[model samples]
Target: MKKNKTMVEIWQDVVEIKDLIRSIILSFIFTFGVYLFVSPNNKAKELFFGLVGAVMGFVITNVFIKPKRIIIFDKNKIKE
Candidate 1:
């Protein structure tokens, strides 16, 4: 069965609304979760940890979620 996708344009890019929301939630969770582990007194540490968290979130999101788009190449467009 083919499932219909609900896509929307945000900042001139089209994305599935559901996936966008999921990405937001997951990134927030990972960012905040890791941020919480660092001591509150050190601002630099917090920033570093938060950035690491964001990267982790990006990687995890990519791992679990597949891209909804496909690219097609025109053979005639590129001639060797």
Candidate 2:
């Protein structure tokens, strides 16, 4: 018989460090793209905005997008 898994267990087992790192890197690139487009006026403002963008990007990607992708990937992996 097979054991049923909880959401927490599935996430813990499926999400990997490499995936997290990849997400972070992708997020950074996205943040950098925004920074380039905006062209902030002052050095301080630029730095602050860049940092904020990077953090927001990381959080959004890590908290939301990554898990969804991981869940889909895990489901496919299990099916294979």
Give the best candidate by lDDT. 1
Stretches of candidate 1 above 4 Å error? 77-80
Question: What RMSD does each model have against the real structure?
Answer: 2.5, 11.5
Stretches of candidate 2 above 4 Å error? 1-18, 65-80
**Per-residue CA lDDT of candidate 1, range 13-42, in tens?**
778888888998999989988899753758
Q: How many clashing pairs per prediction, in order?
A: 0, 0
CA lDDT for candidate 1: 0.84
Which lDDT tens digits does candidate 2 get at residues 1-80? 13442223244455545555668687888688667766478888787778777877887786754453432334444543
Candidates in order, TM-scores: namely 0.80, 0.48
Q: Candidate 2's error at 79, in angstroms? A: 46
| TM match of model 2 to true structure | 0.48
lDDT of each: 0.84, 0.64
Model 2, C-alpha of 60: deviation from truth (Å): 1.4
